[model samples]
Target: MTTDSSDLSQVDEEAKLDLTQQIRDAILGGEFAPHQRLIEADISARFDATRAAVRTALLNLTGEGLVERLPNRGARVRAISVDEAVEIVEVRIGLESLCARKAAVNITDADIEELRGVRAQIEAAVASGHLVEYARLNQEMDRRIRDIGGHETATRLLERLRAQSARHQFRLAFHPGRASQSAPEHIAIIDAVLARDPDAAEAATRAHLEGIVDVLRHLD
Candidate 1:
């Protein structure tokens, strides 16, 4: 008996999401290096998925800025140009600083405690050398901080930039001592926010992004 078209469509969508996540994790985990070509046939073979499913996954990744597809060159992990990298940092500096400033004004005691809890988890991840977990916690902390601003527009923009930012952060987190150094920086921001000091919170956010920009500048 033939399956319904809707059932077939649902299965296809699930396959695409699964493969997209796998490819995204691989790229973010450095298995798929920046600018590394992604051959459809190879990916299809490795994942035991249909070429169509692989194509859809690649397209989804491309939308997320994790994959790039060129006319004749096919797909590859998206490589940020120096200019693009600098621009991303500049955008982050603006958005995050604004979020911190607003968070300082609107954040409640509960917010501070929740943020502190996440910060503690991040510290634990750092101490244990769980680099991946640290990155995930760090991202969560940033999201929570942004949510304190209560500005949907700013938060949405930051969220889009964050996906691109993750690629850089994943690479940066791997460098010796990077995660350790970043932990205290986050503490400073948390402290400023907890104190409801808008200026200090904004400055702390800017300083953190500046440090990231410096690191990106030195990368090959």
Candidate 2:
């Protein structure tokens, strides 16, 4: 039996996608620091991929705003400046508020219950000073709202922006009293959505992220 050409092409595409995701996750997870050089040979060895494959993956990530390709310098993780992070959050305020408004209109009972559970966990994490856990729960809440809203375009844009700004956000998590302040804002968003009030949900989401923009403006 001969393997079809299309089958080979499909396999290659899947492999490329898998490699891309692995590298993207490493960058977002802080395994690769901002602006650190991504030598093709080193990445190939680390991920057991060919240099050509690693190069392709890096180029793909560059388009996603998670990596940068310097002229004659190969590739490295993209470093987002404080101003860029503030801009990203400002954009998110609009997208996330839209999601919250739609979620309020579209959420089912099950979604409400699931979000309430996440809210409780967020409160517990904040009360216990578990910064990392709180950060994770915060992401979970955003993800849940996006899913509930079913806005594919906003979800895609938010994912890229989130990855690009991950470093700034991670740092924000550990800022003094930031979690305490953030928890209440997230809870307000959840409450508004749970109440099925689209206008209130949008306002709460906007207020929550506008506060983030203010904090980012002052971030060292």
Candidate 3:
């Protein structure tokens, strides 16, 4: 029984993706600490995947900035510095404020209602101490905001920036009293967009991100 070459190639691709997501989840879930080495052999063994798949997965994660590859050293979970975090927040502020301004012009009443619903779910997640759910909802909220803005280029840029910020943002969400405090900020951004106030929307988005950065500074 000979396996087709194309079928084997597809299987390899699927294996790589599966391993990639597994490692990415581990890093995001704090199962793999920042700067912790990810030995390819061990990961391949653990996931019961080939070393080639594990290497491809690590490389994909490196592109996402969730993992780093050193010349002599193997891959490890990326450790973002305070300065890098600040830069990420700054970029997000610029992009998100623009997203809000555009959304103010583009969003419909129905979109606003949907955003409110998502925010409500986020609040519920927080109240229930479902940190993972909250993180997922938070990302959904951001995507909705970006889509509402109707800017393809900006949305793509914001997506990359958000990917860079994902781990820090997730950790920040778990900070003491953070989830409760964040609701009003999210609401403010939604309200500004709903009111069709671009200036207010931009200001609200900036303030919300600035607040997160400020809190992160103390937490750091």
Best-first order by TM-score: 2, 3, 1
Ten contiguous residues minimizing lDDT sum, candidate 2: 50-59
Which candidate number would show the highest TM-score if scored against the true structure?
A: 2
lDDT values, one for every candidate: 0.86, 0.93, 0.84
lDDT rank, highest first?
A: 2, 1, 3
**Candidate 1, pairs of clashing residues:** none
Please, what are the lDDT tens digits per residue for candidate 2 over residues 17-77?
Answer: 8999999989988999888999999999999998888988998899999999899998888
> Candidate 1 overall Cα lDDT vs. reference?
0.86
Candidate 2 C-alpha RMSD relative to the actual structure: 1.3
Off by over 4 Å in 2: none
Q: Give the TM-score (vs. native) of candidate 2.
A: 0.95
Better of 1 and 3 by lDDT: 1
